[model samples]
Target: MMRTRFAPSPNGPLHLGHAYAALVAHDTARARGGSFALRIEDIDGERSRAELVEEFLLDLQWLGLEWDGAPIFQSHRLPGYAAAGERLKAMDVLYPCNCTRAEIAAAATKFGPDGPVYPGTCRNRHVDPTGAAWRLDTGRAMALTGPLEWVDEIAGRRDATPMIFGDVVLLRKDLPASYHLAATLDDAADGVTLVTRGMDLFPASHIHRLLQALLDLPVPTWLHHPLLVEPDGRKLAKRRGSPSLGDCRRAGEDGRAIATALREGRFPAGISLSQGIHQTP
Candidate 1:
């Protein structure tokens, strides 16, 4: 059975951009007669909110999307990440970094997709276990399942590779799994086969692919859809104060208008009468 997920960070509400991602995953799963699911990706402990998580679920349900299984939340799975990190550490693939955010910024000038991209500060430095974020050692690079070519039924085949995303973070100092580590682990654990998300995350795919290879997990087929950009071409972001799905629902918008707005982008995807989510028991 094909499986896919709509994992959203609960740090913020489901904006229009997220709605597109949900629609793509929801439609594709139904089209292929596969299972659709949801995963709460709250790897960052600082910003996650339970209310926003509720909003994400309500919004997806309102949009007529369905899930195949119980929602898998990352915060509750810290043990799995710790286990995977232990494996990589056993192989000397990880090292603790004592460098602070400021120090890393000073060492690295050019920034990659996720900014500064870490200078691998403690990749070779001996740091006390009491402090600092851990970094993955990439000196011994591992290859992926394939050359990373995947077809997005909408956008065609992509040839993106991992070089752009250098040594990634597997575990944070405070003991949280980085997005890469948590997402890869959850995808495999949940049996996901197709991953449809915004193109903004295309660069991160390489990082995720690397984790998948190391953990001996199946790398899912990817469909990197174009992001829902503002009129100025800037991609939507939760921090940008973009309206949330909860906002639409409160205004009493129906599902059809919300979906059309999501697809066309002519206007915001407000809630519609026909497409709103019916509460499930």
Candidate 2:
């Protein structure tokens, strides 16, 4: 059976953008007689909040989105992430790096899809592994996997060029796993067949494809849908302080109606949809 998921972090309240993504995942799975699962991406110890998980669940329910099975929480899967990191370490494709953001920003000369491309400063250095991040050796990883490709429902077939992001982090100094590692592993563990998310994350699939090949995980098809944006074309985000669904619910607004309107390309004034440009993290 085809499976899709809407994994949301519990660092903030759900906004209309979250609503759109959830509805797309839910409706697509239901339409094909498949399953839609919800995964709470609450692994960020510094930012993730236990209370917000319940709030987001309430918002999802209010929006008439029902996920199959009990929700998966990343916090409970730390050991699995650690094991995956160890597997990569065993492959000799991971190296410890202690570069600070300031150090990287000052030293990096080229920018990749996710930000300043890592200069491989620690690739050859004897940095202390303590309190250091684990970075994937993208060049070596690609050489081992050879040329690869993944298909997106909207973007068509594309080559997997993980090098664009340089040697991306697989494990962070403070977090058990980076977004790329954890999300890929979680999807495979959940038997998810279709990865539905916003177009802004389209570039991430390249790195994910590499990880899947390295870990010998099942590859899933993807749908990078358009994003809900403001009138000025800024993608709605929690950091931008987008209005929360809780606010709408408290005002007695109809959640389903809002979802229907969104499906029909009808958004509130100053809110629009866009195929957002590829972003830098």
Candidate 3:
């Protein structure tokens, strides 16, 4: 059976954008008689909040979306991430990185697709690799995998070009696993067959496809939905004061009604959906 997941971080209460993303995965699974699961990405020790995790569940329940089994927490899966990191290290495709953000920014000559690609400052520093953030040598890894490709339900076939991110971080400075490593591993671990997310993340999928090849993980189809934007064309973000779903629920608004409006392409005041082409639900 098809399996999809709605994975959200517990750093803040979910907003309408998150609601639409989750609804896409939920309704897609239901439409195909597939399984829907929820995963809590709380590995960020600095920002993750236990209270927000509970609120996430409550908000989803209020939305009338049912998920299978208990929600998976990234915090509980650190050892697995560590193991994966070790595997990449053994393969010699990953190296220790010790450069600070300021140092990289100063040394970067030009920005790549994802911000300034690391200048590989520490790529040959010969420092002790332990307890340091790890980076995937995208060029070297791609040489091993040769050519690769992935399919999106909306955008169709795409050749994987992870080098655009340069040497991407596999383990973060503040956390054991980076989003590229954890999300890829988690999807395989949860048996997710379809990866549904926002169009803004379409580029990250390139890096993810490379990781799957390196780790020998299961491949899943992707569905990148349009983003929810403000009137100024800025993406809605919790850090930017976007209203949370809990706020609407507490205001006695109907969750199902809001979800229905989103599904039917209706928007609330001060909000607009992205102009990106739609994908089948």
What TM-score against the true fold does each predicted structure earn? 0.86, 0.97, 0.96
Candidate 1 stretches greater than 4 Å from native:
143-161, 264-266, 269-281
TM-score of candidate 1 to 2 decimals: 0.86
Candidate 1 lDDT over residue span 1-281, tens digit each: 88878998888778877888888888889898999988998777778788787777788888877887788888888888889988988877778777777887788866777778676666766787666566676545454234545444555555645555556667887647887788888889888899887766666766676667677888688777766666556677788887777888889988667787666645543322122111111
Cα lDDT listed for each candidate: 0.73, 0.92, 0.90
Ranking by TM-score: 2, 3, 1
Candidate 3 lDDT tens digits, 1-281: 99999999999889999999999999999999999999999988879988998889989998889999899988889999999998999999999888888888899986765678898887777967666789998888999999999999989988998877889999877898999999999999999999999998888889999999999999999999889999998889999989999999999999988888989989889999986652222
| RMSD to the hidden true structure, all candidates | 6.7, 1.6, 2.5
Give the clash total for candidate 1. 8
Q: After superposition, how far is residue 97 of candidate 2 from its true place, in Å?
A: 0.4
**Candidate with maximal TM-score:** 2
Q: List candidate 3 segments past 4 Å from native.
A: 277-281
User: Weakest 10 consecutive residues, lDDT, candidate 1?
Assistant: 272-281
